[model samples]
Target: MSTHPLIGWAVVHPWPAAGIAAATLAVLGAALWVTVRTARAIAWPPGPVLVAGTGALVCTGFGADTSWRFARDGLGMTDTTERAVLFAAGEIALFACAVMARANKTATSTDDAAGTTGVPGILVWAITGALVVPCYATSGIVGGTIRAFFGPVCAALLWHLAMGLEIRVARPEALSTGLPAVVGRELRERLLSRFGLANRDRTAEQITRDRAVDRAVHLAAVLELHPDGALSGYRRRRLAAAVARSGAGTNGEQRHRLLQQLAARRTSGQLATVPLASPWAGTPVPDEAYPRTPLGVTGAQLRTMDPLAAVRLVRAAHPEDSPAEVAALCTGYGVPVSETQVRIALRAGNQVAAAPAAPRPVLASEPEPVLGAGLRLDVESTALVHPEVQSRVPVLAAAGTRTRQVHARVPADDQTEPQHTAVPDAAHPVPAVPEYAVPHNEDIPESDRDVPDPDPLIEQARTEYGTAVPSYRALKTRYGIGQARAQRIRDALGGTT
Candidate 1:
């Protein structure tokens, strides 16, 4: 029925047809297993090609085995190993085509998602079925049925290859066991650098040792979002690391000092804080929807806002900038704004969502307690309020301290003035006045030596007032005599009048 030995033997011996078919199927299955194993052990397109090529060879071998006899008789193989040589050549060509196709697909896939290596779903089977056409011409039903299985056998080998073409499945990031892996792994030590997993299951000592790196990575992420040079968004740790990286200790004093400066900038208005995007926080808003600037990304909705509304938003965004500064900034941005315009928007407050009001600084003006020896006053207790401290603010003015409000008009509390009853410390017994003007001190008695002649000043005071007993204040005012001299005159007035 058939010319081929194996096919003829199976046909002549009816009982063995099933056995021969099973044996052939078994061989094909072995070849398929090896092919799949090779594919798993290798990389992408090559793995796929190896698996496909091996199947192609195994399927081709069913009709065209590498055996010399088959090469010589049915095929045109001349040399001893020519059959294998030819098959190998075919495999190489197939592999080259597959690689070129994959390369083309990879290039195009970047721009076109649908662009990828494609294998016809029915190709192997179709080819195998076509090859079986010759079998039907040679053999009757029995032979035809046996040889017809060649198509299925070949297609079965290529099943994995065809399936792989449709879906380019990727392996997860997993390291394969090998010498390169052994050499590549960090030999010193490995620490979790991921922010999310940083502290997880870490011991106190490990955390303490690795915190600097963790902080640095965290800072890097923050800068990715906000990206302000001196601002607090994500640069504090980066700036600190720069100091430490330049040979300071991980938590060294120099590093700490740099960090302190950054912290001060954050609190003062020197550095602006902006929104940061973090993995832990989830996917960031799209760049188109959230436009980015030197400060940060603002929502796309800002594009629709009117001029006044936009100014208000800018004011809110950069609260650290004064209204005039913001106005100048807007004008520079070609918005044609002025300081007055910004002020008007701020006062209107309705155009933009306002930020929470910051707490105002209260300067302490509570009177300082005069804690020294002579007198004491506690604001809480209300002991004699220091009238001199309140009224003598001119004292501070003289010393170059300007006081806005000095209660100079408020009369000093009576307790502060000297007691008038102090009859001027009993003056050196008033010596009798010398009779002549400009009298020589030697002409006067020793007891009366230092005494000034009050007769002229006395006559002047007596003429101005009703009597010679001139009051100390009246004598001081009219004669311009000081308090001590006036006291002496007043004492004389009593006896003389």
Candidate 2:
């Protein structure tokens, strides 16, 4: 009697079945290892490959038997050698997949974590996704449902990843705000040369952080980052062009000479204009100085920036711009960068941020001074004190019982001289001064005046006597003045009577 057709198949092909099962177990073990290892979110080298292969398997999983049968029956080739070769190849492929998964797992923990991705990984996942419908129908309506949900989601993930690969960063160290930063100068001007407008509206610090300018300049123009750290997509010329123009070799001597030339050009504003000349010519003109080009940093400068720093620039510039948008903008600006390192850079920067006290509160107080070590009163005295003289005069210590002499600067009326009055201490009793009080000399002639006008005396003392302070005897003998007038003149000249 003939045995049932299905009864002996497993018995007849036990080795093949066992081989398939073993390959499946190997793949599953590798996959589990990769899943656990990649939890750190570091770039896994084989991640995209696994994603592509698995997606293809999912698409073909339901019809895998039928495809195999079609290859066997429709083609009509059932040679034992071919079958063994095909099985061997499949087993080897599964083992290779397992190795790739193990590699990703091993790499993340080691210092040789050479895991990375770029445009190629994105293409593989894309192609695998594109192959879904053409290769196999997914469990009838279930596949349709899953595809409907998975299609856009997968596309979005790929887009995000592609964008991540494009972002670059140029992280400047957090400088101490205690050093009065006068930024917004050439550094800011170089950054914003592409914006094509007088950025006078924004402050220097704000301009330093704008994402729009991150890639517009070259690595050299700002003298901040390494010459190779330009962002990838800014729409301006690279600062390296200056080096190329100078014909510097990688040799130390040539590089040194090139650096000197660049320094000279920078001092003269020649490098600032040279990089700006090509891109800005037709863009927008902030002034005749930058004619037609939006005054902005050159794109070549941004290209040299580290991918992580560019992401920071975009986030700082437009907190709302999506990673994809930032990456695209970087590319458009000629700085081609990835947004992947953005999160890492931002997290690291935030850690550093907690250490530095905020440096932006310098504007709360003006540069003038405050009252110190003396009695403080805000009374507005009726004094015609010159601002220059007001600054020079010292405010005396106000010990209530102590007598202190301050120039009681009484404003001039019709009188020619500024009257000086003796200010007794606030706590001291006033002494009678009937004899001390001199008659007013408002209408007195210069020769007859009691305190001889200070200006004329000062002028005469400076010119003829060649002294700023003169003696009472000099005036009494020189002009034949009496003793009382001479004494009065002496007192006005800061002398005792």
**What TM-score against the true fold does each predicted structure earn?**
0.24, 0.17
Q: Per-residue lDDT tens digits of candidate 2, residues 1-497? A: 87866457757988886887799999999999998888757764355544654553443343333334434554454875675445223223332333443344333322322233333334434444443442234334665445533543343344333322222111123221211133645566677566644567866544443322232223455554433445433312454443444334444655565456446645775545655456646867554321111325445555566766655665566678766566666666655665555446456322223566667865675443334433233334544643211223243767223333222322345236656866744443333333213223442335665453443554554466543556655776686654445544455444432
For candidate 1, give the lDDT. Answer: 0.52
Q: What would the per-residue lDDT of candidate 1 be over residues 1-497, giving only the tens digit for each residue?
A: 53998777778897889887899899999999999999788765546656775675565555443223334544666776666666333224333444454554444443224243445323433444544544454455677566556533553446435434433434223232323334565431343444333456866654544555445545655665577656873377564654455333655754565456446544555335655666687786564423333345244434455667767777767889887787766655446677778888888332465899999999988764454444454223345643211322134536543323211222245256654632333533554442222224333334334545544665555566545466556665666644445656666565331
Show model 2 residue runs off by greater than 4 Å. 1-63, 77-95, 100-266, 269-497
For model 2 the TM-score comes to 0.17
Which window of 10 residues has the lowest lDDT sum in candidate 1?
Answer: 402-411
Top of the candidates by lDDT: 1
The per-prediction tally of clashing pairs is: 0, 62
Model 1 clash pairs are none
Question: Lowest lDDT 10-mer window, candidate 2?
Answer: 169-178
